[model samples]
Target: MPDENFYLDNDDIRFNLTHMVDLESIAELKEDVGSPDCAYESADEVVETYLDLLEDPIGVLAAQRIAPRAADVDKEGCHYDNGTVTLPEPARLNVQDLAEADLMGMTLPTRYGGLNFPATLYTAATEMISRGDASLMNLFGLQGIAETINLFASDELKDKYLPGFCTGEHSGAMVLTEPDAGSDLTAVQTRAAYEEDHDHFHLTGTKRFITNGCGEVLLVLARSEDPEKYGGGRGLSLFLVEKDETVTVRRIEEKLGIHGSPTCEIYFNNSEGYLIGQRGRGLTRYVNWLMNAARLGVAAQAVGISEAAFAEARAYAQQREQFGQPLDRFPAVQEMLVRMRIDIEASRALMYATAETVDMEMLLSEKLERLDRKDPRYADLRARRDRFAKAAEVLTPLAKYYTSEKSISVTTDAVQVHGGNGYMKEYAVERLYRDARITSIYEGTSQIQIDRAIPRVMAGAFEALLDEYADRDYGTVALNGLREALAEARRSLQAAVAYVNDQKLADDQRDTDYRNLTARMVCDMALDTYLSYVFLEQARHSERKAAVAAKFIQDMAPRVEMNRQYVMSGDRSVLQQFDLLTGAQS
Candidate 1:
């Protein structure tokens, strides 16, 4: 029998999917687009059938196959031999199972043989897959490479590559990072020289820390222009290169975690390439789009890992005995378990909300592309598209930042719950802890996400969201205290935002120095309030959700106040004593 406690049995996920999100509208959109394979009469039927078809098989596979092999996969890891990268037996089998199930290219168009599900459904699947094996997500999440191709590649290129991706005959990698160009793409030095006679570009450079770099398809960012003449990002272009004799996996990194995923240092020695989209717009346009999707994928991974960690902690707390009672009977252990569970739910709430916004943005954008400007509804469609786009811009980074940080914290507590056992490889929490460490570092660091999210908060992008939450009745007397706490958190967020805005207007130097610190405080304040409201909303349907909401708000309110006070304090000691702190010569 399959484990009954797999992802499909997650009450939080089920509630969010069935009750929290607007599945009816999404179903309507999917049906209107034409359900090529399945027929359904109503929106409810469409949603129910879609969820059943996607989630059931995934849950069984995760429980019966992936979870059981995850530890061994991590142990065996990936191997490099004679320029060929090999996945461990378990990892290889995992991929084969998913491929045979036709689970890849989920969000691509049906014409490309994809399921064409919305981003919300796809994100949910990603979360489940990550829960099963965080390492495997590194491979499964590369579907973004196919989505990028579908979005930007010419028809000929799409025809050549996308079908194979849908059929699971090809996997892809986003080859962006170089030795010196980790975060700053402007420093990318890989060269792509166009050959007029051959009608193809030849790529020559080294890319470092590329996940799945050994995959069949690679989207590489290379400097197509002379660096001496056009320096920085302007010289960069996006190119699609397939595995060939010219491309070599020189070495793979021995990482701290997710060992099953190969991080390759690849050498491109005059590899054949096809340009994607326009020249010089790789970083400014295509890569930015790809990064957003990747960041969201990372957020989902974080949430899934957190859920897994929490489950391990909770189960252990219930089973482990101390002084003739379960460890869960002890107050300290109980506190840790409760906090872990709350954090997992809160992270999921934030992720699903962001995913819903992403779905709105994507579907609306696609609709606008086919819309005629002269049509009566074009203006409305355009307006909605832009609105959702802005919301996604703010929420995606916010989700990524909050969930990644929460995953680290939750996993730490999970380890703490296991005591010495968690430190040993005998338990899964040790591996989970290591896997959680990389979430905030990759797909844009937590610091980078804060910088991206701050402007959105200051510009009033989330003001309407606060108002909407404030107006909801929540339909319960017990949730009133939680509502008040949420309101207080929002006020604290606004105060922090006000302080940062004032500093920006007061002194340019001070603003530049303290912007990151200020943004961090405000972003935390916003997340606490947003998640509290989500929990309060969820409370209407489940008493368990109400308990979680109450605990979260009670714990979060004081932190929000502390951040608010720190932001308003105008303490510039870090800036004032920078040289002293660093022992620099003046």
Candidate 2:
């Protein structure tokens, strides 16, 4: 029998698609996009068709084709043997399988041999692949890199690169990070100077800690102007650098995790590169656009890692006997298991909600573009596109921050459940434990995410978005309760903001301590409130989900309140009682 329970619920994704954001009308509007009379099937029909595919053999192929090789790939790792850094047999073949199945170009338009699937469906595929092996997700998820090129690449560039990417003939890498330029990509030292005769730029400098650095195609961010002309982010530009004699792989890093995907230290010596988009706007325009997409990919990777960790811990608890019966019988073990489930479910709910917003935005924009070029009669499509784009802007960072942080927590608990066994390489949790650590660290770290989110939260973008969801006439009683809970949570968050602003502490820039403390409180309350709404929405869609949703809401609501209280209490003990808490000489 097929393991249906291992995958996520389709109804939950659909609920997010329909209620979490307004997708039905957008789907209808974008339906007859390319083909006349090709009306979009119902949202439920779309969800069912996608689910049936997920339940099919293709789903198992990921676990069979990729998951089994995860350990060996991690052990053997990618190597810089000879001039070519070669991937292990399993890693190379897995990419080939995804390509052959037309999954590589999933969200791209069919004109480019892609499936033209919505971003929501692409996220579903991403979650499946991630569940099987978190390491492999890095390679498989490079479709976003290809997406950047497709969206911004010149016609010649797209024709040459995108086809290979879609067919798995080439792999893509985002070459941004360097030894000194970690978080501050504007400090990038890589130089790209244009040649008047050739009209192509020549790149020179070494880029370190690049994911898929050995990929066939590289999107590099380099300074095109005089090195000293740029202060922070100015005078930088995006470049399309291909694998060539001049671009050499100097070395590969043996990283803490994600061993299957090669991380390289690449040296560019007069490598011919084509300028992408415009000059002096690489950091601001191109890289910003690419990072937004990449952040969402990280969120999906987190969900995948969490699922893998949850499965191992859940199975271990059921099978591992302690004392007289299964370890699951123990109250402590049961509590751990429940917490694991709750966290994983909450993370996934947040991730899916984010994906829905992304999909709507992407599809709407595409629809409006097509209308502008080919069908000006459809003006409403343009308006819908703008609305979704705004929503996606606010939701993406929140989802990435929540999911990545949750992955760390879920994987940590997974190790705890395994006890001594988790420490050993014999169990998958050991590898998962390591892999889960990177999600929060990379793709604009959790701190960066909060920095991005603060403005949106303070500006009340999410508050307005939630108002739309609140207006819906939900059919389930449990869902209604969740809405009420979210409403209450929101009220608490608003109160925290008011209290902080009113207090003198909020204005003290010197004391970043208070701001950091308040940011966490506001984010947590908002996250819980958002999650409460998501779970309740799930319950509304299916009776089976009612208990799961209700259980989560009941447990999470109090934590939401507690987090709020922690912030609202105005406890400056960290400052006033700092010396008492940790003296210089104990």
Candidate 3:
């Protein structure tokens, strides 16, 4: 109702395409990509085609068909009865439209009936779909499952399952969690034993908290090795199992948000399964790759939700009257609106930067796999590939962490802007509020992201990345003090990271507890600095963008110091006073 085309209506998405993203650089790396449908005359042609495709079909479909149905889809939700899962009509239609549009297997090879697009495009599409309906994104975003199959599965396995996936005749579920294993996937109790007679494995175990567990295809992580020898994640191997009598959904969870998404408990009993790759590499390799994709998808989803919530709040503020004037005229309300807008913009920048980095890593892997070792370009290209690989590993988690947390803040403020009516079902922001809550919890929580990112940051990889961006001509002298301020922030951040890395922070019982305790502060400072640079990159093209950059850097300056001070102060109150503060029995 508000905007018929989500992509067309958003100027930032377009600006990123035209300004921030260097499609030519990414396309040159993909010049010889052997996928059948990946044929491109030039990088320019690819960019043009991508923009056209987004405007006509992907943009229109998400705004018109999906967003319009989101309300009813959420209300109706999924119906679970007699071990059969049925999606609400509206939700089904939302998914069917994307299927018909041939968008389901966005990044898979064309030989598998896919579009063979880059992850940046896939991620951007994910954001658009999530903007339409968070529930639909759960279903639509399952493309990662298909891509994983294409990547790791044998040619025979790919031939059997992938065409169906790309055609949208089959959907998939990533089955990893168990009752005893939520975040610690190493504790998964699922069992998959090889049956000599059948020459395949038979899976038997329970998987809990699975999204889209009712889908036709399931990628399972199970223990295939002897626990006594290869315990924990080492014993795990990835498997593919289809929906059959032996594979059943026990029950779906009643969630606080994203109600249309079916979070299920599944029981696999003697279900015939095929290994994706080598044994004992499930958690270490295959699932890790899949989870990275899943985390990036969630980041895009968070940004989309933020966009929708901000739109609703912005519209309401302009139209609604309070104290004999429009609510937007009030200084208090205006500040919230501006802050929400800036935060949303910052998160979008972070997410896309991550997505573009993933694109480089993904395409580079494809190229290097086939390149001759003696080729002239091999050495230089391999170095480039490894560099992007390192950046992608860290950025993916940061994108997921920052965008998801920002969505919570943006959505909460949206409701606050709307007053009492925002809490009611009459408005879409109510559902958006619920949908935004899950982004930070799933696909690795914010804490998990910090644990993953800080080591890489301390290794000097992320800072080197920021410095690489610094090489791009600023087009001018970073608006005078903006450059100096960013330098100071970077200095403060480096000192804080050094303090966190110091050996003196160790405790008698646990050496790394201080690092764990003060991690969020270090990560927060890093994020603020990253956001400032991201905005400055945008600030190069337009006066409006320049203003946006200044606003972000100026606002986040104090935050950078606070986090630095807290980390540098060696604050261990959480660890030192755990029992005292929490009244623990022990």
Considering every candidate listed, which one attains the maximal TM-score? Answer: 3
Model 3 agreement with the true structure over 380-413: per-residue lDDT tens digits: 9889888889989888888899999999999999
Candidate 1 has an lDDT of: 0.87
Residue 272 of candidate 2: its Cα lDDT? 92
Candidate number with greatest lDDT: 3
lDDT of 1 by residue, 1-586 (tens): 4555465678788888887888777776666534565466777887886688556677778778888899999899999998999999999999998887777878888888987777788888889888989999999899999999998999999999999998888999999999999878899999999999988899999999999999999999999988888889888989999999999999999999999899999999999999999988888899989999999999989998998899899999999998999999999998888888888888888888888888878777766776799989999988877887888999999999999999999999999999999999999999999999999998889988888888888877777667867888888777876687677778778777877776854445547556666788888888888778888888888888788788888898899999889988988877888898788946
- Report every candidate's CA lDDT: 0.87, 0.78, 0.87
TM-score of 2: 0.90
Every candidate's CA RMSD:
2.1, 3.4, 2.0
CA deviation > 4 Å runs, candidate 2 = 1-34, 37-53, 226-230, 372-383, 471-482, 501-513, 569-586
Task: Give the Cα error of residue 458 in candidate 3, in Å.
Answer: 2.1
Error of 1 at 376 (Å): 3.7
- The clash numbers for all candidates, in the given order, read 0, 0, 0
